[model samples]
Every structure is written in C-alpha cells, then in structure tokens.
Target chain A: MNRNRWLLLPLLLTLLFGFSLSLGSVRIPFGQILTILAGGDATEPVWADIVWNFRLTKALTCLLAGGGLALAGLQMQTLFRNALAGPDVLGLSAGASLAVALIFMGQAAGIRLLYEPSPWTTALVASGGCFAVVVIMLAIAQRLRDNVSLLLVGMMISAAVSSFVGILQFVSKAEEMQIYIVWTFGSLGSLNWPEIAVLTATLAAGTFLAIRSAKALNAWLLGQHYAQSLGVPIKRSRMIIILSTCILTGGVTAFCGPIGFVGLAVPHLVKLLIRTSDHKILIPASMAGGAALMLFCDVLAQLPGSTQVLPINAVTALIGAPVVIWVILRHPRMLP
Target chain B: MSPDTPTIALQTHALSTGYNNPVLHLLENMSLTLHAGELVCLMGPNGVGKSTLMRTLAGLQRPLAGSVTLEGGPGMPPEHQVAVVLTEKIAGVNMTVYELVTFGRYPYLDWNMRLREEDKKIIGQAISQTRIHGFTHKKLYELSDGQLQLVMIARALAQDTAVILLDEPTAHLDLNNRVEIMKLLQRLARETGKAILVATHELDLALQTADILWVAGKDKTLLTGLPEDLVLQGTLDEIFQLKGYDLKTGQIYHTAFRNKTVALHGEGYLYRWTRNALERNGYNIAASTPTDVTLTIEPGDRPAWQLRRGTATNLYYSLGELLKALPK
Candidate 1:
C-alpha cells in the first residue's frame, strides 16, 4: 500500500502544483507556464511576470509551509505522545507571532532599537521566540511529567501570548493593525526570493534533523522507558526533536502567517491513509502529504476564476478541521 | 550451587536505591550477586522498593549510593551486558512483532539502522526461543497479554546480553499464562546461560519456579539463597509479612477464633475443607475428639455429614446446613 502511495504522490503533487500555478486571477496557460519554467519567453510579458514572479513563489511557499509544518507536527506528536499535539497547539507558532507582533508594534511606535526591521531580522526574532517557548516547554516537561498536563500548559502559554498580541493590537494605529491583521490571515503570494531562501535553509536544516531522529522517534513510540532500554539517550533525543520542531514551525510562521491545520492535521491524515507510525516512513510521508494538502488548499484559497484569494488558514481550517475531527471520532485512543 | 560461588553475571556492591525528593532511603547496604544460568525472583510487599532496585540494576536510574557492576569482558560495554524488560506497555507502537523484537539489537545497529544478516539471525533466534515466530508479521495490538509478554522477552533475548532484568514479566496474566511465562524464562536462562532477574508479586509462582529467591528482607536488608532455603529460614515470611497466610504450610489462618469449639473427623482433602468451613464459621477446632459436639463426614455414593450433640444426632446432606444448624 505504501509503495503504491509513494508512486502516486509525486504525480499528485505535480498535478496539484500545476493547477496552483495555472488557475489564478490572470489564468495563465499551462503551455506558457512550462515555457516560463523552462526559461523561455511566454506569449506575453505580463504572463511571464505573473507566472515567474508571483505564482511560482506562492506555490513554492505553499510547499514549504505544508511540508515543514507537517514534519514539525509529526515530531511534536511523537515527542509528546499526544495525537492532538502540533506546532500551533504547543504555542511555537504563537511565539513566532508574538515576536512579529512586537516588531510591528515597535515599528509603529517609532522605536529606535528595532527601528524598521528587515524580513531577516523578523525571522530571527521569530526564531528566538520559538526557541524561548521550546526551552520553557522543556523546563516544564522536566517538572510536569504528564503529557496531558504539559499540553495544557502549552495551551495556556499560547493563550497568554495571544492576549499579549491582543494588547499590542489594541495599542497600535489603524495602518499597522491592518498590516498585522493581514499577516495573521496568512498569505502565500507575498514571499519574495530572499524570504524563500531563508525558509528553504531552515526547512533543509529542520528536515535533516528530523530524519536523523527517526530511529529514536520509532523507539519513542513505545515510550521513554522502553526507548531508554533500547539505548536511546532520552534527554538528547528530546532536545533534538524540540529543536527541529522549533526551527521548522518558527521559520515558516515568520514568513507565512501562522498557517493552521497543516501541522496538526497532516500527520494524522497521512497515518490514516498509510496505517503506519514508523517515523522513518512518517517524516517523508508527512512531507509529501503536507505539500499536497497545502497546494490543494492554496488552490482552493485562490478560488480559480475569482480575483480575491481566501486566507490560507481559513481554507485549511475548512478542510483540516474536519480531518482532525474525523481522526478524533474514529481513533479516540490515538491520543494519549 | 550457591549464588556467591557461581559465576556472577550481574552484581551490586552495597547498593542503596531511593529517591531524593523526601530524602527517603529504601534499600541500604544491600550486596547481592545474580548468577548466570539461574532464574532469580525479587519478592517483596508493595512499596518495598522492588522496582527501585530493578531500575537501579538495569541502570535506568542512578542508585542513591553504591554501585552495580556487570561481569563483561574487556571490550564489552555495560549496555551490551544487560537488557531490561519493563512493565510499561508499548502503547501505540505501530510495528510488527518482528520489528518490535528487532529493536532489541539497537545497541549493535549502525547509525543507518540497517540490520545485517547476523542481526536478522539473532532476531529470528529470539523469536523462535520465545515462541513468537508464528506472529512475526502481526501488529503488537493484535497480540494477547501473554503473547506480548513473550514478544518483549524475545526483544530482550535479541539483545544477547549476559543478564536480563524484567519488572513483573508475568503481571496481568492468568495462572496458566503466568506459569508458562515463568517456565519459559527459566528455560531461557538455563539454555542461554544468561542470568534472569524478575521482580514479581506472584509469590506462589516464584516459589515454585525460581532457582534462587532474592527477598528484600525487613528493615532495608537483602536475603539471597535457594527458594527452599529462604522458605525454611523464614525469610519469605519476614519479607512478605502477610497476616493471614502461613508461609510454611501455605495455608491461610482465620485470626478471629470463636468461643465455641468443634471436633471434626474426616480424612484427606474433605477433612481439610470441613475444618476450614467450621473455622470460617467461627468454630474453634479441637485436634482431639470433643465430647460436647462433634461433626462426622460419611463419604459414599451420597456423601453426608452428621452432627452429634449429646446423642441428638442430625444428619445433613450438605456442610452448609450442618454448620447453620449448629446452635448459633
């Protein structure tokens, strides 16, 4: 079954990615998309500009957001042993949003220290925020012991950060608030090459770490004691899992607004489709599943013939929420 | 074959294991040796630190004081010398029986986690030894408790260590399953020449199957000897400190003796049970024949009981009515 799925995935991904690039407000032809992709001039200058500069970047953004979030979610689920666990649920995304919000509000208030930060500065700050949350979570996990309690604590931390962002929204002016609100809506069409480069690097690093930890994660499925008996150094594996999750989620959230549903829903969706929990298979499978789902959702967000694009988060929630619900109702014991 | 004389697979020198939170010390100054080719049972009451000692021995937790040493060769590491099977269930493990057991070779696997032919052979040997080769492809959730326990034992076996430690391997099993698992472990120990240390609450099974008994004795001490020797030396009784059960005869004593007395005359198992019924009904059983009242069992095609109270004889078919009619 997995072999069949593996054969089908690339074709599906290509078809969806093609659909994403083709059916926008401008409605570029498939032939022209191929021409532009192959470095030739399209029939029209406008088509090339839209296809190469805008649609291609947006499509790649969707892939990165999808794959990175899904892998991060898989790592979090295995690490915490909770099916409901995800990048957003653990407040890592909220941490990134908090960092971005602080900068937006700081820039709006004319703060000299941060004074009109660049996209790179924003990404770094977001990573710092994510790193801080992971550290706090690790500390709490050390003392807390129970996975459910730790998840609850993560939810509480997210709530606390959300309120802080709420305060920032209240204090900011109309223009700055609009920018932040639009960011919170999550957009794929706005990623430039520089931002994509940063996202790519972070994704590559996080994916490397995740794949390396696959064996340890497999041992972890039995749980910590049994994993330890198998010679998995518990503390080190945990640290690596958390680090990878933070980099993946934080990097993406810094570029795209906190895209929901992909992280929490994709792993379960893949597991449901494939029926295996081996992380060696899961990490890559999640990447493919994540990328496919994101592109599909991004196309839905585009609405094809319509001019206005839906918020990626909204489209994902419309689909991802039901998948999560299905997972919960169908496999109640999946979560610890 | 004394424990000290035999080749030691694992040993502890004055080991004291406990938690630091409340500054509570459980076992202190405990020195013991676990010998190869022997099945040892660590028996104690609940909260007597059996798990603590097991974890300490397995190197899962640091002992409060003292040291645990494995008799490994110069090149062999401690992890290669010992393997542990914990009571913690492998929850949500989405792997086949084969994959689960193959994890036992983790210490020897390379960074790529590619199993060699030798590793596969060891895994196959482990599966066959634990008799779980029939379900090598089946998921863990599909197995029963007994089968899962065997799979875990197979995992430890695949580690190919000199010593194996299990925390309640027979727990959550029925009588027959418990006996089967115990016998399997005993066979593995003897055949493979690996020391097997099992911490369990099943006293009867332990006493019946274990080659040696390591009783966590009263007041933070240790007792190690043969199972019969421990039983004869009263160490089992001291360690368990059970109130109603007699360690020597393996009989339960009803502590609440009534003022009334009864003399029962019967033979064999029937006599034993009749006395038990009378005793449970608050009758002080007289060893010699009594004059006031006496109960007699007449066994035949229709078994009956007769109660004689000053020649006013009453015959009852069942002991229940006989006990009920005895002027309460």
Candidate 2:
C-alpha cells in the first residue's frame, strides 16, 4: 500500500520546491518565476534577479544541505548505534562556527590578513576546521570501545569549541558581532553559485563513499566482532564512514551555516518508513527524504505575506522536535 | 594410523586459548579431531573457558598461541567451514526472521550481491527445519527467547558449514526448551552428517544426548571420549563431586538430603507414577516404607485414615493403585 506513496515522492518534492520559490514578502508570479528561471525575456529585471539570484539559490541550498546533513546524521546514528548521534554532536559544526567567528573577530580588530578572502574563502576555511575536529573525534572513537564514552568526549569537545566561540564573540566589535550572529542563525540564502558548486561536489563525493561502505555498514550492525567474522575490516570501514560524514557535514556548515535536526531526524524517518536497517535502500532513501524535508522547512521559514524570515535552525527545531518527541514516546527502547 | 584419514572436520593442533595477550591459558597444548557426524559436548563449570574455546573454534577470536584448521571436504572453503551460534543476542531488533536467516549467506555473497534462488531455498529450508516457519515475518524483538535461539540456529544452518559450533545454546532456556534444542542439535548432526560442538553446563542432559564429551577440567586439559566411558572412569564425579550416600542400594546422589523420613507403601506402574509425582513436588521417594496402608474396600470406596491424631481421606485398592488415585 505504501509503495505507491514512495512513487509520489519526487513529484511532491518538485511541487514543494517550486511553490517555495514563489514565497517571500515580495511575491513573484509562478509563470514569471518559471520564465526567469528559463533565462528568457522578462518584464521586470528586478523581479527576475530576485527570483533567479536569491530564491532559486536559497531553495537549492536548502535541498542540498538538508540531504547532506540527513545522510551524515544517518551514518553517524548507525556507526554509534545511538539515536542521538549526529554530525553536529561530534563538534564539527562548532569547529566551523569557531573558525567563522575567528575570521570575523580578526577582521574587526583591523588586522590585514595575508590572503584577501571572499565569502567562499571563509567557507573553505570553516570546512577545513570542521574536518580537523572530525578527524580528532574519529581518532578518539577508534581508541574507545564504548560508544557512550565516545559520545561524551564528542560533547565535551563541542562544549569547549562553543566556549571559544563565546570568547571570540565577547572581543568582537558591534558590526563584526552582527555578521557573526547572522552566520550563526544559519541561512540558506547566503550560498552563492561558487559555494553551491563546492557543496554539490563534496556531497557527491561523500555520498559515493557512503554507498561503497553500505555492505560493511550492514555487517557492522551485527557488532564489531561479528563484522570481523564476516571479513569486514572494521577500522578501515570506520575511517571511511567518519571521513564521509565530516566532509558532507563540514561542506554544509561552511556554505549554509550549521543546519540542525535534518541529519538527526531524517535517518530515523527512513528507518521507520522503510522498516529495514539495510543501507543499500536506506542511503538513497535518506537522501531523497532529507532533500524533500529541507525544501519543505525552507519554504516554511519564508512565510508568505510576512516581511520577517525565520532562522533555518528555528524552523528545523519547530518541525524536528515534535517528531523526535513522538518517536521517543512511541519507541523509547530504541533510544540509547 | 594413516596420516590422511579423510582429515577431521575441525582440529586444534596444539592450540592454546585465552583472551588479551594470552597471560593465562584456558586450554593449553590442546589437540583434538572432531569428524563429521559427531555431537560433542564441552562440559565444565563456569569460567572454565568453554565459551572461549567455542569462540576460538568459530574463528570469532584468535587463540593466544597455536592455530585452528578447518579441513575442506564438505563443499565449503576452509575459512567458511565453521558456523557459530553464540550466547549473545544478535544486535538488531528491526530485522525479520527471514532477513536474519539470510545473513548466513554473507560468506557466499560478493560485492553488490543479491540473494540467489539457491540461497533462498536453503534459508527457507533452515527456517522450516528449525520449526520457526510460522514466525518468519515477525521481528526478532517480538519472539520469545527460545524462538530467537531457534532463529539463530537456523541462521547457522543457512551458513551450511561442515562444523556447527554452539556456545551454551541452552543457557537461558527452561528444561523443556533446553532438551528441545539439544534434541534438534542431535537430530541435525545425525541427519545432515555435520559435526556439532556445544559447550554446556547441563551435565546429565549432555551425558544422555552427546555422542562425545569434550571435558574441560580445572587442570586445563581437554579430555574427549564417549559419555558413558567418561562416567565410568569417574570423570563426572571428579568434575562434579557426588555428595550423598544410599545405605540400602549403594546408590549416590550428587546432592545431600535434608528431610528423609517420609515414605509410603507403593508398587508397580502406579507406584512409579506416584514416585515421580512426589519427587517433582519436592517430597522424597524411597523404596522402603515407614508406613503401611490397608486396602479393604472396592475401587469406589473412600475410607478414613489416622496420622498422628489427625484424620485423613483415603482410597481403596492396592497401595500402589490408591497412590495413583490421588490428584496429579
């Protein structure tokens, strides 16, 4: 019965994304938006720019970031076997946040950096920082056999990084603080074409690696000893999964700010829906489900007839928290 | 003996087993050959490394020193020759019985592999053989512990290896389930001609069921022989000390008696039934009698009796038949 429902997913996603582009304080007609998207002649250049440059990119950014975060989140959940495990839980997002904070604070202090940086350059640096933090966490996880202990260590690292960001925020000037605050709020609107290109490339690579590790992950679901018995190189598989999660999450955080909940919720949703732990189906299902969710949430963030736009995190929290609470109430045993 | 005697199904050539750097050996300088069509039971007390030895044999954990070799003859690779059912529960609860059983195909599958018709048929057969056919669609978490155990055994069966190793497969089961699982293992060994090795603490059941007893003693030496042979050699008494003496029949009990005064007159099949029932209900049954009852009425007669000034109800027949008249 639900198989037919799956067939409707792509159609629903296209409709949701198309409808989301027309939303905002200044409403653009759907036909004109389509015309502008097609790059044909248009009546208003301003409206064309607004639809083509702003909403389209923002919507696409949400789709990609949502999918990427969800995939990473699902991977982390499986690896740790903890429902609460997410890419953000490992402090990767905090790493990006801290790096961005440093850049803003340094600029505010009137220090002339060696490199002339663009927004994309800042994103790249942030992604590098996130990668470093993930590497550290992976190293620690490898040494610790206990999953809860590994989670606590990751939480401690996240806390430490957040404190450092706090210190940076304290020393920064008002204008710099404003820039940092806006970045922290997390907006899909800020990703330009260059950042989108980078995001797409990183997501593609991470997804490919995840797919390759699918069989190993299935073996891992039986525990490390069983996986080893099945001829899986546990350490090597762990490394690949960690690397993929870091790259995918780091890229999203850099370009679109640290979007939350999508990763944590999307995998669970896929598991709940498909009713199987097999990653062969799960990985692709999570990607599609995550993309649709992000697009939906982004559209909700820009409520029609309102001048004010909601923070992406706030929108995700609004949607994700209820589902999480419901999941907890229904199947409390699944929680670690 | 010839050097090549159709190579034993599983052999530990001077194998020493332990965990974490091999500081303390569980079984040292141990060498044994288990051939196909044998049911071997590893009997020992707790912490005797029966589980560890099983793990070593299953290739889940490495021995501290020495090696385990699986001789190829039963249509399987040497590496894939052993299948294991450990005491630990399989991790995933969301998986169906069918899916869990199909995982036994792991060693046979290549990258990007799908289940073949042959694999499906084997899995289906295993499910049926384990008597878990009705629960195929049920999630593992929904099944009873005994049912889950059968599923695990079915998974091992699906692996289709020559050597099947079970580490305390009956550890948590009730007596009935324990005997059922043991019988299943025995039947599998006989029917499929596979070597089945089980490590268990149920000495009486193991003695009755196993073809060969692999006794792991406190001295860390493994002795393998027929069950009756081991029993006759005082191995069972040496490992599990006999405690009580019977002065009348020269019979011994592994446990000491607390209350030995109660006895009644009984004889024949009815007497046997009464004895078994009384024993099960925590009353001792002895051959000699301390009290006698007179049967003076017909089958429908209910007479009165006296025991220490208290009157009790009685039945009419031979003492054995009267005892059988009591409610079960």
Which candidate tops TM-score?
A: 1
Give a tens-digit lDDT track for model 1, residues B1-328.
6655778888888899998777778899988888889999998888889988998888778888899988884367656888889987565556788888988988887546889999999999999998887889888778899999999999999999999999999889998899999999999988998999999999988988899988885888877889988888887877777788887777787744567888778887778888888877778887675558888888887778888898699899988788789867
TM-score of chain B of 2: 0.77
lDDT of 2 at A226: 59
Q: Deviation in angstroms for A228 in model 1?
A: 1.8
Model 1 chain A lDDT-worst window of ten: A106-115
Tens digits of lDDT, candidate 2, B3-85: 45533788888998887642878888889888887899998878888888988887777788888878774354533688888
Residues forming the 10-long window of minimal summed lDDT in candidate 1 chain B: B87-96
Candidate 1 A-chain TM? 0.93
**Taking the tens digit of each residue's C-alpha lDDT, what string does model 2 give over A111-171?**
5442455677778878978987977888897887555687788789899998887877777
Misplaced by over 4 Å in model 2 are A106-117, A141-149, A170-177, B1-7, B21-27, B73-79, B220-223, B234-273, B276-328
Q: Residue A210 of model 1: what lDDT? A: 92
Which CAPRI tier for candidate 2? acceptable
